[model samples]
Target: MKSITQLENKKVLVLGLAKSGEAAARLLAKLGAIVTVNDGKAFEENPSAQSLLEEGVKVVCGGHPLELLDENFELMVKNPGIRYDNPMVARALEKEIPVWTEVELAYLVSEAPIIGITGSNGKTTTTTMIADVLNHGGKSGVLSGNIGFPASEVAQSVTNQDTLVMELSSFQLMGIESFHPHIAVITNLMPTHIDYHGSFEEYVAAKWNIQNEMTSDDFIILNFNQDLAKELATQTNAQVVPFSTVEKVDGAYLENGGLYFKGELLMHADELGVPGSHNVENALATIAVAKLSGVSNQAIKETLSSFGGVKHRLQFVDTIDDVKFYNDSKSTNILATQKALSGFDNSKVILIAGGLDRGNEFDELIPDITGLKKMVILGESAPRVKRAADKAGVTYLDAKDVADATRIAFEQASAGDVVLLSPANASWDMYKNFEVRGDEFITTVERLKG
Candidate 1:
């Protein structure tokens, strides 16, 4: 493990006061680094900044001042959510100062071999599944990173014997200098977060950064079903292990209703508790990770069969009057929503979609609207989605928000139909995040049940 002493006496600037930034600042201070934290949120609004000030660390709140860069800081730890276009970040680049994310700090200090998972969708489910399978197999797995808990928090106590399973976002991956994972898995690649990265190519490059420091000794599990992932195989130095739900591959594949590893049966595909064909791909990726980690088939099977799924990703909410409600608030992109829709019988589905406009066109989703009983649209991108629905010759209605959308969907849904809240865009337009949007949907559904 890289020594934390490397940070001692180093001048470090942490941008943003979010969870990752706060964790990083505290950790850096604890490691004896001279840390300065800059956040756009005011000091009074950020208790984290106040707490850091008490620790004798410098706190610059309310906004990122360009003058702060004059401090001649040796390194900068940036929150993944902060775009590279930030003035301070641009200045840092101009000065040739190294900018790193909390993920990099976590990697430098962590003693365990990290298993980083990234992709447009299924990251949470795949990460959770890997950890569960490893734990069941007698190997301890500590979950962290984009799964909510900052990796810096988990890195402090992680041992070499333990496996650190992380769900990494493209934003986090973009800032890494040497954050290498022993087992890296990209479930699948699709156009996502274009606004953040500025373009599809840049977004793809950011996701590919996960393998930048990996060696041949490392394993990169990819989706063989995805052509982009297959193309990525040629670019990585790590051992490429492909998983597929389509046809048999060298690594993992689904055959005759069974999941197989190198032609050996691991478990029955139907036995997996998670619904959807997309999840089968997730399972395949997780199975590869489990097998590589020395997890036994029995443990893998047990975890797969018992694991209901991660919250907010096609989670079954309830059934009212024979109509089922599903919460897929985690579907924050068109590709994700399309996959969610593909999970159900189109004729029996009433879809609630639309959210923050990420400058993404909904044309790709037009064809998938086939057989959808109805579409309830809302948020910033509702009009764009409605246009696509119109082109598909599908019926739709606009609601003011998720609550109104839920009510409309429930009213429209008939017995035996499924009400799916799978907004094909981010939740920033109306809700704090996808979780809040999902909780509101779930609460609304429960009220309907009452």
Candidate 2:
């Protein structure tokens, strides 16, 4: 069982009964912590909650209660989906109660050093790549966080010597106070979760918080080209390593179809396991993290040559005749979509963009997507996204859902054009989550092919 000595036999409240929430509850219960779950959604509506309640987890469904959460529990293991400013959690804080994200909880239980990845996009790519590099280098590290297993899941089985590789989201970082990883990376920053964060500064502050909590012995790797990253690097007390795709720095970067670390060629950049210049940058970031962790350059090179990229983050499905169909369901922010659009050399692209709008500024992406042959938009921000496209001088179409938008996307795309499902918003309006949204896009594309 995962070590929960700090929380063992203690009263803990697991908020939001989602995957991570339930996982925390189950582990805590096994460790003798009294676990009670609370979620705002109906038990029947959320399939995950049904199974969780069946496991002897006392659950409060549909709404929160003032009594169950009133400082009775010593610690609150919060699901990342729930906001930091959530009323119930706020109430607990009034009494000096502590709140911990599932990720932070995982960090405490882990006796091993950790590698953390955070960014507007490509965090999963970098996280997976870095973990893969470690594992391939004959070291053991688990891929967890916004990518694979939740950190709670990783904590259940890790040993003191094993490495913990995590992808940290802005939400998960929101509640973190002192949780530190030996190696931390912010792949890049772009305006994301503007709705959840109130302002762009607040959003950036949350992203910067990962580095903010680092101590002197900790190592931070960042994209030097991003102004926010550069500014943060100067201010960080930890050892700051700067990585780039366009230029070489004190760390990794790309050269003529090859990757370089501080001017030394490490691997062929053109042969990076993932597609896009973004992945090249991700590879650079991952390599830099691994090297800092003491992984040899030879192992890093070997891993990059053989590792396949993560699915849904620029995953190319199939080409029907001449058009390429790419699923960037992982592109949950405008900046990520901008990188995706820039990665391709095509002059014309049928961009399927829109989802639950997250307060991202569409202005930054307005100019470059002129090659957007036509955009078949979906979800809550369709009209807003259409207007952005209109202002950018691109043709536009509207659809009500992912499937409908993809259907329209197929019809609008031509032999030489690229069809991209890079929604610059969250995936809650028409789907359960981003994975569901991405899966539905691929399924619809396969149906269109037939």
Per-prediction CA RMSD (Å): 13.6, 13.5
What is the C-alpha lDDT profile of model 1 across 249-290, one tens digit per residue?
999999989999998998898899876787898889999999
Over 1-450, each residue of candidate 2 has an lDDT whose tens digit, in order, gives 345577676888888765567677777777778788888877655544677678777788898886887647888888776676778878888867788788777776677778888888777667778888888788898877765366876777888778888888888888677678888999888876777798888988888878766788989998987877888888888899889876668888776777887777878976666567777888888888877777888999888876654567877655564466778998888888877775443234788889886665577778656545678888887777877887777778889888888888888776445788899888988888888998888888778768
Off by over 4 Å in 1: 309-450
TM-score of model 2 (CA atoms): 0.68
Model 2: runs farther than 4 Å from truth? 1-4, 44-55, 309-450
Question: lDDT (0-100) at residue 113 of candidate 1?
Answer: 93
Clashing pairs in 2: 9-32, 258-269
The window of 10 residues in a row where model 2 has the poorest summed lDDT is 340-349
lDDT of 1: 0.87
For candidate 1, the per-residue lDDT at 68 reads 95
